[model samples]
Target: MTSIEHITLEVADPTAARTFYSTAFGLDAQVRLRASEAPTTGFRGFTLSLTVSQPSTVDSLVATALAAGATTLKPASKSLWGYGGSVQAPDGTIWKIATSAKKDTGPATRAIDEIVLLLGVADVTASKRFYVDRGLAVGKSFGSKYVEFAAESSPVKLALYKRRALAKDAGVPADGTGSHRIALGCDAPSFTDPDGFAWEAASLTPSA
Candidate 1:
């Protein structure tokens, strides 16, 4: 199975982008590269390098956005966090584009280090049992339906919730259908719960 490796975001500048992310999410920048010096292909650290489009194309896109009354918070700059930058849209949305740090390659020694994903399900108790029966250990349960599953050594937590309720809390439409699939790793087994939520189980390895 293929585990979720990383998440990437696109932004206007890299330097200013790193600052915004560092301040907002406490995310550390791992690498920085200029538009001219960025690789044309392949992955850099954990994040895949971005493709630099032409200046005229970028300018036109920016101008069009500005014409629509978009405000620019930080113009753009190269910083410690690799490519892309940060911008605040007129609607107050803050965006950042930068290389995500590679997962630490150190030994697994922490009690908890990361949260993989939260799943929305129709029934919580049923879902928890489904996972528990499949070899996952159920942690503290919040009431009857809300629960968290602790994956051994990965610092990843599997969260189960009511679908419509979760969607409402997230300010999104409660139209999501079917179970979401989460890939684990090679040699580890994968299982889908009652509500159709899928998870892959495997031993942890040092990330780079």
Candidate 2:
């Protein structure tokens, strides 16, 4: 019953990363944590925590990556997106470095949780039945092809549409580039809609 608490991104520089994420994603820079304010345990909201690496460590990381054949694509720079940087792994995998400015204020005290994943499917009725038959409880209808499924304390919403239509809405090529599945938590079974988009459920476990 492990739940996903938050997502963290390691950045080359803290101050630059913070400024970039705040500007690019429209995230607020309300919370700032000093070294003493690090968390001990439990769930917290989506937060951007910064740790300044020692000079030697930073140099070693960059050297080791380059020696192993990583290409420096975007050298670290202070941009509108903050201090942005990227490197291309030997296999052509691009790694981006940026700081996120979101904070997780812990779990919701009220009855509901926030929407974690948005799933798009080809057929609404068929997709709804797939989840319902699998023991997921369906809530009120969201729209023509959208429905809500309650997963214990967590809530999952599914949006149905043609594959092409969804791609158009997202402004990404429908060519099936990138990932077909998105993970939820550690133990939760992965789910995919009729159109092939995958979704994972995030919730508070018993321990939390």
Candidate 3:
């Protein structure tokens, strides 16, 4: 079964990013700074979705992230889908905290139940096909608007959405170019997806 294993976020300051993630989500340090020659001016077209067990947990996380220097993109609020919100980490990585208050079949956790890499792609169908061809099994999907890939042995799920829609979801502008802020760690041979998302071949390292 295909699994994400790990997800790397390119940031201007790896040390600061590592600190922010650790403080905000109790995630271990796992960021690599961009080379001096690399330009750091793109949205990365993705958001890290952290699924928690309940609404209060979502609020607590959003608050923690904000206190840790994350910029609030959307304050925690309840919608028909559930209670959640978005924030931009100090290093510019967008993080989404969400909860449906549903019981998790996965291991019980007080804070984060799972982490999902949500990519904003120009062509959802094409990108979906790209991963499906590369061994990703489709989970729940809604036409070309959104799609989720099942996580087998991996703790993180991979998902795709229309670029503009994802921007709206993250409460950020959709217009972006250059390096995506995130990278997928996988064993499927390093390759770029149709929408320009890169997957690096690497072993999984579970975060704290």
lDDT of 1: 0.40
User: What's each prediction's clash count?
Assistant: 7, 7, 2
Q: lDDT (0-100) at residue 114 of candidate 1?
A: 48
Candidate 2: tens digits of C-alpha lDDT, residues 72-125 = 755544444343344444322233333221222343111111323334465667
Stretches of candidate 1 off by over 4 Å are 1-113, 178-187, 200-208
Off by over 4 Å in 2: 1-113, 142-144, 155-161, 186-208
* Order of models, best TM-score first: 3, 1, 2
Candidate 3: list runs displaced more than 4 Å.
29-37, 102-110, 203-208
- The ten-residue window of minimal lDDT in model 3 covers 29-38
> What is the C-alpha lDDT profile of model 1 across 37-136, one tens digit per residue?
2222211111111212332322333344355444443343343543333333332233322323223233322121243355667778887777666666
Clashing residue pairs, backbone N/CA/C < 3 A, model 3: 44-180, 44-181
* Alpha-carbon deviation at 32 in model 3, angstroms: 6.4
Please state the error at residue 2 of candidate 3 in Å.
1.1
Worst 10 residues of 1 by lDDT: 42-51
Best by lDDT: 3
Candidate 1 matches the true fold with a TM-score of: 0.41
Tens digit of per-residue lDDT, candidate 3, span 1-208: 2877677776667677777877888886333334222455656688889998887778778888999999999988888887889999987789999998643345434467888888888888988888888889999899989999988778688899988889899998888777775677787678788887777776532332
Better of 2 and 3 by lDDT: 3
